[model samples]
Target: MSALQLQSAAGLLLLPALAWALGGFRRGVAPRVIATALALQLGLAAALLNIPPLRAAFALIGDGVNALATATKAGTALVFGYLGGAPLPFEEPFPGASFILFFQALPLVLVVGALSAVLYHWGVLPAIVRGMARLLRALLGLGGATGFGVAANVFVGMVEAPLMIRAWLARLTRSELFVVMTAGLATISGNTLVVYALVIAPVVPDAAGQLLTASLVSAPAAILAALLMIPPAPGEAATEGEEGIPTGLYDSSMDALVRGTQDGLGLLLGIMASLIVFVAIVALVNLALEPLTGLTLQKVMGWALWPVAWAMGVPAAEAATVGASLGVKMVVNEFVSYLDLARSGGAGLSDRSRLILTYALCGFTNLGSVGIMVGGMTAMCPERRHDIVRLGLPALVSGTIACCMTGAVVGVLTPP
Candidate 1:
């Protein structure tokens, strides 16, 4: 392998090394487990991106996401009329065509949420999550409940996943609690993935698969980070699951439809509110920054994450630009970061840089997410609220590191 190629694979260890250092070289059985997880995730990512059959199978994710959006729009047009219909002819079109990201794209989050609930109610999702959770438990030596929550994050999201194992949250040790939060932050939810796929289809092929792969890889990546930063002490393990994941939260499919749409409505409102507040704040920051640094908020964020991108073997010249997306993912949210990336597609970035950025920016580790995580965990097990607060920073750090670890794997991958 060339020097850069070697560096790419070697770079996978950087986040773990950083975590170890942060852990004060804590002694635990985690090294083997974490390394095993990283290796597995990297192998899967490489195969998915390069091996012809695997790549072809995973490519179905993009088509599925597109079909999903198209289907959802059809429903919207039936219910919402021209408000949700195709754009009308314009007398003078802008250089870049404009449409409402909220109405046109974000409504898919509701469809996804409702569909997920229906599938889970029908026992389809639980069967899959349960099987995957057992596999993770066997691989990572995680206690049943922790493994279950981690696996569930792939489907429901950070906020809802913990609800699956709520009965045992209070029994988990501080370090184990750290794992739950870290895993939650490390992965993006299915609903958010759909919204993101809708936004970035312009630039990336297999957007859904890449995002899904990131979440899959990052679960163990987050575990690795947590293990290093706060290795479970002797006798410290998550409590075994005492109950199956709750089901029948709704009476019928129609009820599930109502509940899911209600959940999505709340999320849609929250997303809009957050966007308005954050965008205004970023604009203000840029106004002040423009005079002193001749850079905007996004550029500053890029500068902050440049080291991570460089470490991942992104071309040095483009490192800062890609890093800015990481900065946005961490500071704001993945949704905004993705929007920024789509706006700057291939802006002098090589394929390697783009691939790394896609993996790196796929997660729910923004500052705003901390409150939601804490609140959700607290609601599940109120007594652990203090522990959640105490461990929040480390969890956040581990989550960010986890995403970067996945990015490193993508960077090292030999694409077909």
Candidate 2:
């Protein structure tokens, strides 16, 4: 990367620290800790990117993007009966080729949901949660319940994570609540990984794995940022209790399969609906803005986010374009942004710029998500409704910063 790109990436990497400092963590020690963590993470990302062996290691996640695309193509072909109808000379390789990808990717959500129940029943999830909580407790000095809740987010959906700690949500401190909200906004659910992969794999090399890593890396950054924003208050922390999974929910493995398939169908429908409506709204807005501003809403977003994109290490010429995608993610949704990124054909973006954008746009930071998190969490813990309302804006800011941190890391690691 150029010196300017490096500086920009550094600035973005430090943005979470800046947000934390500005939001609350003004004490001498707090600033130092935040700065040190930021530095360490940046250095780690740089080392991983520059060290040939480490990059090779990351590359070994088995090209999830290619697998996803192949599956999607196969699924599409199967559904449309295009396999045999097309002018291909040979028979369709996979009889239900199109169905295979959809089955592999979309069904993952149901499988995760059901497997999560099984894991919970078997105490597997709690064990993982406890391990993650230990790290959070030592690093951020968070309460056991809050730390576990945040850690649970790594594997589960935003709404599902809180269920593990549902017993304590009503009693959680404000700071703890904020941490939960921020974590939800910062990370993507594993169930949606295939969906997002299918959306951007055409544009992003290794889209599934890279986006998956982005979500995973953003989880810790989100927690760290939230802690800095609202340092844990001095008080007795919530304790971990018996949070076992429901064992009798499914009759057998086949039962689980049937239930999972049904659930996946609902989720797929919802995703399709949301994407259609959201994109249509953006189109309508752009139509209105075009005549007034002499440019489309997209161009305006690109212009507005250009500086931040540059700071995330996108090449200067492609900064606006990438920034526009970020703006779409924040203003609309990550799905919409991913679709646009995949279809843009690398306009105004270099290979490195595209990679950075991939990381940057890999979160649930849009306006729609704020309502979803607040509504979902509030429903799970009605007593905490007020707290959810109060922390909504900060959660949004913290989440965005967390994703930007990931982008910065990717930027520094990617060679210009």
Q: Estimate each model's TM-score.
A: 0.94, 0.82
List, in order, the clash count of every candidate structure. Answer: 1, 6
Model 1 is weakest, by summed lDDT over 10 consecutive residues, at 87-96
Per-residue lDDT of model 2, residues 1-416, tens digit only: 67756765676656765776767654323555566556655665666556787667655543554454455456444654544122345566774343333334454455445554555555576687778777767665567778777777876667777876788888787777888888888888766766777666567765666766787677667876777787665654544442442236567666765675576566666666666777789889988988887887778878987777877877677778887888889877887777677667667778877888788787788777787778788898888888888888889888888888788877766667
Give me the overall lDDT of model 1: 0.81
Q: After superposition, how far is residue 211 of candidate 2 from its true place, in Å?
A: 1.9
Residue ranges of candidate 2 with Cα displaced over 4 Å? 21-36, 43-60, 63-127, 234-252
lDDT of 1 by residue, 1-416 (tens): 55666666777877688888898988885557966888788777877777888777667888888888999889877776655655454542764454667767788988888888788778898888898788888888888888888888887778888888887888887777888899999998889998897787788777888888888888888888888899889766456782467877779988888898889888878788877777777778889999998888788778887877877778788888888878777767888989987888857778767878888888888877877888778887888888988887778888988888888888777441
RMSD of 2: 4.6
Best model number under lDDT: 1
Q: Candidate 1, which segments miss by more than 4 Å at Cα?
A: 78-83, 87-89, 92-96, 292-296
